[model samples]
Target: MDIEEVRKVASLARLSLSEEELATYGEQLTRILGYVKVLDEVDIEGVDPMPHAVDLQNVFREDAETESLPREDALSNACKTDGQYFQVPQILDQKD
Candidate 1:
């Protein structure tokens, strides 16, 4: 990529770069793109796409009814709360 293209991208990413940094980044990005171009030329006719390198499986147990924690005990861990409910900071910008 060119220095101007790098400067545009850096501006979009909210980065503050000097002229030297822009030139350095331009060269680095060009090298990275060249490496990716080489990867694109590789043959993978029968290769399966993988999300993870290792095999993974979810192990589940038999589900049974269980007792839940009491309301008073559950509310004990809150930073701030009313008598019956958790009181969190208001997030909206309304007058009410």
Candidate 2:
């Protein structure tokens, strides 16, 4: 990339770069773009496009029916409860 292009990019990103930093980044970006250009020239006639570098598989446990905890037992550790349900402080103001 050129110095002007680097400056424009830095401005877009809200980065305040010095003259030396701008020059350095310009050279680095130019080299990175050069590498990308080289990659574009590589032959891939029969290669299939892949989402990931390695193969992936789902490994999950099978779901099973289970008994649930009793309501009273579940509310036992709660700081505030209305006997049947847990009570919490109001978060929003009441509107008319």
Candidate 3:
């Protein structure tokens, strides 16, 4: 990538980069693109496309229900509360 290409990308991303930063990012993007070009030359005639790099099976544990906390105990540490629920400041303005 050239400085102009980097500048264009920075503008599109709404970035305010200095001249030195533009030059630095241009060189970095060029190197990264070079790596991608090298990957294009790799031979993968029979390789299958996979979602993950490694094989994964059912990795989750079985869900089981347990006893729930009492309502009073759950609301004990609240900063402010109504009789049955937590009270928080209203964020939206009421319009007529």
Candidate 4:
């Protein structure tokens, strides 16, 4: 990548780098891409794909159904209500 292209990417990522730093990163990114190209030529016909760097297992407990609180008790704490539902002020601005 060129220094101008690196500068544009830095601007998008909210980074502030000097012109010398941009020139340095431009060369470094090109070298990294070259290494990736070399890795692309490796053979791995029988390799098993691994999703994670380390193995993991689920540790959650079993779920159980339970009774819930009554609606009257749940709505008892509301400041304003319309018999069965809570009421609140208008959220949006005035409209025509």
TM-score of each: 0.44, 0.43, 0.43, 0.44
lDDT of each: 0.90, 0.91, 0.89, 0.86
Error of 1 at 59 (Å): 17
Point to the candidate with the largest lDDT. Answer: 2
Deviating ranges (above 4 Å) for candidate 3: 42-96
> Per-residue alpha-carbon lDDT of model 4 for 1-96, expressed as tens digits?
987899999999899999888999989998998888977677878988888888778778768777787888888999988868899887789573
Clashing pairs in 4: none
State the lDDT of candidate 1 residue by residue for 3-67, as single tens digits: 88999999999999999999999999999988888777778889988888887788787798889
Model 1 CA deviation exceeding 4 Å by range = 43-96
What local lDDT score does residue 42 receive in model 2, on the 0 to 100 scale?
75
Candidate 2 overall lDDT versus native:
0.91
Q: What is the C-alpha lDDT profile of model 3 across 1-96, one tens digit per residue?
A: 878999999999999999999999999999989888877787888988888988998789768887899888899999988858999878679553
lDDT for 78 in candidate 2 is 98
Worst 10 residues of 3 by lDDT: 87-96
User: Is candidate 2 or 3 superior in lDDT?
Assistant: 2
Tally clashes: model 4.
0
RMSD (CA, angstroms), candidate 4? 11.0
Q: After superposition, how far is residue 3 of candidate 1 from its true place, in Å?
A: 1.1
